[model samples]
Target: MMVLDGEELDQLYVDPSWQSRGIGNRLVDLAKTQSPTGLALWTFQVNAPAQRFYERHGFVAVEHTDGSRNEEREPDIRYEWRRGPVRP
Candidate 1:
């Protein structure tokens, strides 16, 4: 994963064949331990599963983009996880 001094979680990926075995969750937990203050990330808008996963982990969509800044030109959403309690 690409973390910027424990502030931003730039990327986290698990091979499709190895998914659903808790690897992604572990990685996210590690990121949280490293960056207890908070963490932020972006996922493509078309990726519903990813959005759900992040939401389950306490991340909330905080922003949106029209795909202009990314190489893939895909619309994306930014999610953020704050330090304390998870939102309900």
Candidate 2:
């Protein structure tokens, strides 16, 4: 079991070969069942595919922040799914 949050998700990685094979969707579904407040994650502004995947899973952009890591500033988007019932 993992506790998902903005910072945590920003560091998450999915294998390239397995990127769009519904692995992420299934992982998020598992997370939702274990999470008391549903699933949440963050993706970089340039990561359109991940953003779309999250949106398909009912996550919506809830916030944006300066993703400054090691003194480097980058745009990051935060998404959350707090109210939707997970799809079958």
Candidate 3:
């Protein structure tokens, strides 16, 4: 995970073999402690499971990219989480 300017969550990834084991949750929890006001991250559009995970953690989809701005040239989605009541 990469937190930029002590705010944005720039990157987050866990190996497939290490997923479903709570590491991500722990990391996010730590991130919250570091930046409780909010956090943001970008994930590939193809990663549906990641989207679900972030949503479960109170993050909401906020924006999308069309593969034109990343090194991997893949479409992506940006998610954000705020320190307050959850959104439905």
> Which candidate achieves the best TM-score against the true structure?
1
lDDT of 1 at 87: 82
Candidate 2 minimal-lDDT segment of 10 residues: 1-10
Task: For each candidate, give its TM-score against the true structure.
Answer: 0.88, 0.70, 0.84
Q: Which stretches of candidate 2 lie over 4 Å from their true place?
A: 1-11, 69-72, 84-88
Q: Write the per-residue lDDT of candidate 2 for residues 15-64, one digit (tens) a residue.
A: 78877676777677666666646556767888898788789888889988
Q: What is the C-alpha RMSD of each candidate to the true structure, in Å?
A: 3.0, 4.1, 3.3
Displacement of the residue 31 alpha carbon in candidate 3, Å: 0.6
Score candidate 2 by TM-score against the native. 0.70
Better of 1 and 3 by TM-score: 1
What TM-score does candidate 3 get on C-alpha atoms? 0.84
Candidate 3, residues 10-64, lDDT tens digits: the string is: 7677787998899899888888889989998889999999899999998999999
lDDT winner: 1
Which of candidates 1 and 2 is the stronger one according to TM-score?
1
Candidate 3's error at 70, in angstroms? Answer: 1.1
Q: List the residue pairs that clash in candidate 3.
A: none
